[model samples]
Target: MKLGIIKLSVLITSVLLLAFQPAGKKPIKVYLIGDSTMSIKDTRKYPETGWGMPFAHFFDEKVAVDNRAKNGRSTKTFLSENLWQPVLNQLKEGDWVFIQFGHNDESPEKVGRYTTPTEYKTNLTRYITESRSKGANPVLLTPVARRSFDASGKIQETHGEYSDLARAVAREQQVPLIDMDKKTQQLLQEFGPEHSKLLFLQLKPGEHPNYPNGVDDNTHFSELGARLVAQLVLAEVKAQNLPLAERIYKPDPK
Candidate 1:
């Protein structure tokens, strides 16, 4: 009888331990919705890396950054591809959806994907609404500036109307905005025109990185450049009063 009682007590203890074990923690999901500049590309032939590749390092492992961004995809085309649909479905409360487009959005040369400011703003609004409906916060990012320079060594603002439109949409939707175009332009201005080329992938003699016949490309960036842009984005997240960002950065030493 005593042995049976001890066996029953052992069973009870095992059951209690199993019941009190803590549940596995869930990862914080961050969905990156953008274009080529923000997507990972096959760089075997090219020496360029997308900013999105390094962006994940800005956050901890608890934060899962799903880079849904693709090459040559505009805001309109990304949606048409049904990329956002799956992201929305998987998203839970407190997740963030970062939308950065406009590189191709303003390319009137590509009418099928090019969008006017009015249409761009409208599409951004819809994205914001959909994200909110799914209990996820939407953050808008202005397109990063291409490494274009003027005669006086000033970095030109290539985004123009599209950047303004993105800002307006962010304001209307009450979302956080990362003005990467302006920030990058300012950085390039500080570096001067010729010197700023260091951030881009330059081709050497008989060395064709992305293009053949020795290209003079200035649009894409190298790994270091991508990391710097990602750092800027992290800084912007801290500046924008995003709750999740608070843990990522320490107090400024200044």
Candidate 2:
């Protein structure tokens, strides 16, 4: 009888301990560090959608995506703007940050903002080191594909040298890489330039070039496009075998 009683107590203790163990579902925090392609939105009626908008949907409620990305920003400018500090300060172990830039980082006027191949890789290394120091993992993403096309119906990669630099950064850092530029290019080829244009934010008549008729569009994506890119990102995470990705993908229940 005493042994039975002791066994019962042990069982009870085990059950209680199990119950109190922080729900294995501790939120997996995520921070997005990128350019207009990944920027979070405001109420102001901008026609284009940033990929960050839909990325949050890929994960279960246990994951929080804090998109600190901005429009017309680059790796250098993002730091100059002091955006990384806020995310870095709050980052905890097991958290992840996605860094994608290079869109606006290619122009001559943007030289200070555009990191050359060597400098770009250096910046990425710093991000990785800093994030790791803060107990966060950094994921590098290549820039999104541009709308430029060739007569053969090819979606030209306009980012050029920057795209190569991004790939090198990922390789050198030994970080998970989502080749957004390459993936986007392939997807655009499947879409064809004319139809792919649907993915970009369209502008009304007589807007500025960036606004595309002053209507606000072109470089940015739409909600649907963002969601598609998010899906692709998930796929990339799986391909790269990142641990945090498992939190986002689970078998569907009947």
Candidate 3:
């Protein structure tokens, strides 16, 4: 009887302690939806990296960054195809969705992917509204600027009108906006016209097996470029004083 009483008392104490224990923080998911700039690269792509891939490491375990951005997707194509719906289905309260689309959407020459200016705004509005409906917060981001320099040796504005539309939607919806276009332009300019080439997938012939012939693409990013851009976004999160900023872990030195 004495042993039974002791066990019962211990069990009751344990139960009471557990009952009074603080609940753990709820898991939050920050979804990244965009184009090649933020998409994950295949293993075969090697040095080609996406800002989203590195962006994931910026946070504590409480936050998960889902990179739903694809290589060649535009706002129109993302909506028209089977992408957005899957993400929408999984959204929970306190989740965040970052939507950035402009590169392919502005490229009318790319058949089936180009979204007109009106359609672009409509698509952005739909994403924002739908995310809010699901009790999720939505942030709008202008597409990261491409590395382009004019003869005057100044960084060129590449995202252009589509970026403007993104800004407009953010204002109309009162959503958090990360103007990556401007931020990256500043980054490139800081590196200057000559040094900015290091940020993109620029390679000489036989530099790597993937691009044996060489590539001069400025839209996509190298591994260094991706990591830097990801850091830029993280800084913006803190600059905007986002709730998730509090959860950012200590970043790696390298």
Best by TM-score: 3
TM-score for each of the candidates: 0.85, 0.84, 0.94
lDDT of each: 0.83, 0.81, 0.93
For model 2, how does the per-residue alpha-carbon lDDT over 143-226 read when each residue is reduced to its tens digit?
Answer: 888777899998888788887887887787787778888998898889897888778775567553445445435577877778
**Order of models, best lDDT first:** 3, 1, 2
Best-to-worst order by TM-score is 3, 1, 2
Which of the predicted structures, 2 or 3, would earn the higher lDDT when compared with the native?
3
Worst 10 residues of 1 by lDDT: 208-217
RMSD of each: 4.0, 4.4, 1.9
Q: Per-residue lDDT tens digits of candidate 1, residues 1-254?
A: 99999999999999999999996445678899889888887957456878888988776657888999988888888888898788888989888899999999999998788987888988888889999998898999999999988787778889899999999988887888899999888877776787777677766767753566665667777777788889889888888778868547354599
- lDDT score, candidate 3, position 81: 88
TM-score of 3: 0.94
Q: In model 3, where is the ten-residue run with the lowest total lDDT?
A: 243-252
Candidate 3 lDDT for residue 184: 97
